[model samples]
Target: MCPPNCLHAVCEKATRRGLLKSGFTLGIAAMAGAGSLAGGARPASAATDTGPLSFSKITDMSHTLYEGFPTFSGERWFEMERPVTWEKDRVNLNRWTLMEHTGTHIDAPLHFSEDGNSVDLIPVADLLCPLAIIDIRAKAAADADAYLTPDDIAAWEAQHGEIPEGACVAMNSGWAAHLKTEKYTGLDAEGKNHTPGFHHEAARFLIEERSVRGIAVDTLSLDRGLASGEFPVHYDWLGSGRWGVECIASMDEIAPSGAYVFVGAPKVAGGSGGPSRIVALH
Candidate 1:
């Protein structure tokens, strides 16, 4: 009942959407960085404009119902059934008991710092902005404790141009591929995790130099889980009162660099960083 060309377009759109939500990337990867965001971020007050972004093909960077995946509680759990619901006296309610850091949740400043901003306190304007994806998968495959150094970002800039201020600096480490298994965590027998994260210098650049609105990643924490020496990344970003997006599951789907509208938010009341969705425009 549809035009032939339109049908093909629909099929392609469906495929892209599946690939995005399924957390599969068909491109190179990058690493996370520090952030001095939130001071003077450009506000994307309007998101209704259309462009080459293929909103129909938008991807959900949050985790799905996968068991043994990391959560804030330092444990792994996910939904087992489709309709996680309970009904009583015809009062049917739709509900899902997800962890605060489940899916694509933001890390409010309060998440780490003793006196940091909460999800509700974040300005609605800061939540949306252009996105920057930095790939560091190659380094990660070699060293588990590999961090995204400023030199790496500099190299990326040499090709992609200087990372514009107010852009959401994200990383693609290819770790999403291993999320289903323990190795994806890159945890060693010593119970220490060895994964790619923000390099101290890279963190400083994103925060003090480029002034990105926020830092996002497809990993457990902005800093590698194995970090214990000084914690430079956390010390810098949190000290600056910038938020972090953690446990993100995808990045390869987005354009290398472009104007994207961020739509992720929290529960407002009892939320630290709830599962949220993000979309990019060409």
Candidate 2:
């Protein structure tokens, strides 16, 4: 048993281990910016090193999972069944059925690359990093198929300083508010979708130039809803051995540049994608 005075530390240790079992790492929530928490939380060798930041509130950046939630074309929706209700079995056990890519989730490299790492194999450092929020909501509102260009990223960097190498760059398309409506998907008469996403140039710049950990978006897919032919964005990014986070929620609540994002997903051995709980601490 932990000593009374060691309760806090013990709890933190337990929490960290539990997260690892769940396919997450407390390092994602604890450490931010361009650093890595690969092996585990900071070692005892660096216990006293408080490089930057002190205290802050953690914000939930994921969506609520429920039956009939939105889904991409040809993907299964979410479902929940309480097979063992408390009244019947003196316990409450739930059985869930949903697509790996449903709701807010991380698209591991395997989603696009034939021999890439699966969700469980993605390094902890990649899921946890400083967030670069590019606000192009106004442009998206005017044009449903708006693309976040390199110029937009440059403008954001001009104000927030250069995006740190290995950070997670997220597109703030202001689409979360419309999730309850058909407009969130923005399907057109020809059955084509019109959603905002990063331009090919922007993705290339973030990957090749910035050396970012990955890209994220608050929409159905990382690529625009109306992307024609092959998913060039996915092919370009994930195919390059990186990952993607999609359907992120609550971008408006966090700061544009300083927050740290934590992505928690199930450790499905070879899952190409999976349901995730993403959050940010500012």
Residue 243 lDDT, candidate 2, scale 0-100: 76
Q: What digit string (tens of lDDT, one per residue) describes model 2 on residues 197-267?
A: 88888888776677576789999888888437558788888877777898899999888987777788668
Best by TM-score: 2
Question: What would the TM-scores of all predictions be?
Answer: 0.72, 0.82
Please count the clashing residue pairs in each candidate, in the order shown: 8, 0
Task: Sum up the clashes in candidate 1.
Answer: 8
Best by lDDT: 2
Task: Report the poorest 10 consecutive residues by lDDT, candidate 1.
Answer: 26-35
